[model samples]
Target chain A: AGDAEAGKGKIGLCVACHGTDGKGIMPMYPNLNGQNATYLESALKAYRDGNRTGGTAPIMAPMAANLSDQDIADIAAYYSQL
Target chain B: AGDAEAGKGKIGLCVACHGTDGKGIMPMYPNLNGQNATYLESALKAYRDGNRTGGTAPIMAPMAANLSDQDIADIAAYYSQL
Candidate 1:
């Protein structure tokens, strides 16, 4: 199942923009709180695969470049609950 | 002071993905609640200027492209408090 606490541990870089609350820093960075894990997983996968291009994609593509599928799940899970 | 009320009015489009509470829909869209106004403002400006590019930037760029500085500010102000 989605583990919010586990995801929180993995969000080091994510917190830089998205913020600790998952509320996002604003403007470009989006809010992560209460988003569906499915959408989060898909977007992260797209960023990792280079299918999606937009603001911070380059950065996220690289950041997500090494993430395992499970990691994506965990991160998505954590933010979704927020 | 930041007008959360006024910002809420302009956040109609934002709420589509971000949700009414500023919590993002998940994985892709970010949470908007409790983010810093300055950070939100900067991010929005980046989207407007095409400086930051990533997952949703294309849609956001065009979405934000038409916004004036004050609009950006207002939106930022709105989301930061949420």
Candidate 2:
């Protein structure tokens, strides 16, 4: 997947909760750094589609709503490298 | 949180993708068996709220749409134990 500088900006909201390192700030946040890219991609889609549910739903549903398939792939690539 | 047998039924959808053990069979699925509870909870919410995005969005968005806060918490507890 190609790196999108635009996607990096989109990830800011994620950094706020997951941290720049993807280690996550609170117990409520997950460590996204080094997570499997394919897995992360599925998770993002699941959140968008509503297959998963939890405390972060309110925050995730909207974030995922607008993502294109390519955007999802790109983000997944970024997180996988972190 | 109290163990909800009912919640267990709801998690079946997750099992299909995450596997009964949470190890995840596909590259697209994440291992949920041992994720941190608080982190998992927040993630679920992020999906529900549309803050996260990815390949599994279509499936996840609708799944989380109807979940109650308690249901989310109970499921998080179960996944944490797995």
Candidate 3:
């Protein structure tokens, strides 16, 4: 449902914590490598909408707030595959 | 890899926070509904082994500490399909 190539190009904002390989850079961060695409998409949407909160939500909400559905989908696709 | 029925029987400890429907009862708690099974299993294992830290780790660690791999798998399976 999303273009992974496009997602890869759009990952600049994510790489610092999530890493280029989708593995979290820190212990507190959850790993995204091989995660579920649908789950990722929903999580991103929830973040963008300010529906998901707590833990890293404060950090993630601002980052995800501007993402379009397509952006969320692409990012999800990119990360789900590792 | 896991029996949902078996997992269903093991959810007593999880229901207080996660709910019987796998949806988290509180915003700070993550909803386990339809989450990725592999991710859930790994996360439970991480909590049990004290490899995952920060946020709710202190609370989760003790809860997950005694779970066998089979218990983790069954729980994962149960939550993943919710």
Second chain TM-score per prediction? 0.87, 0.81, 0.97
Q: Of 1 and 2, which scores higher on TM-score?
A: 1
Docking quality level of the chain pair in candidate 3 = incorrect
Residue B7 lDDT, candidate 3, scale 0-100: 98
Runs of candidate 3 with Cα error greater than 4 angstroms are A1-82
TM-score of chain A of 2: 0.82
Residue-wise C-alpha lDDT for candidate 3, range B6-54, written one tens digit per residue: 9999988999988888766654477676666766887788678765455
Q: Per-residue lDDT for A6 in model 3?
A: 87
Quote the lDDT for B7 in model 1. 76
Interface DockQ of candidate 2:
0.32
Worst 10 residues of 1 chain A by lDDT: A50-59
**Candidate 2 regions with alpha-carbon error over 4 angstroms:** A1-25, A32-34, A41-82, B1-7
The DockQ ranking, best first, is 2, 1, 3
lDDT for model 3 comes to: 0.78
Please give the RMSD to the true structure for each candidate, in Å: 4.7, 6.0, 9.3
Q: How far is B53's C-alpha from truth in model 3 (Å)?
A: 1.6
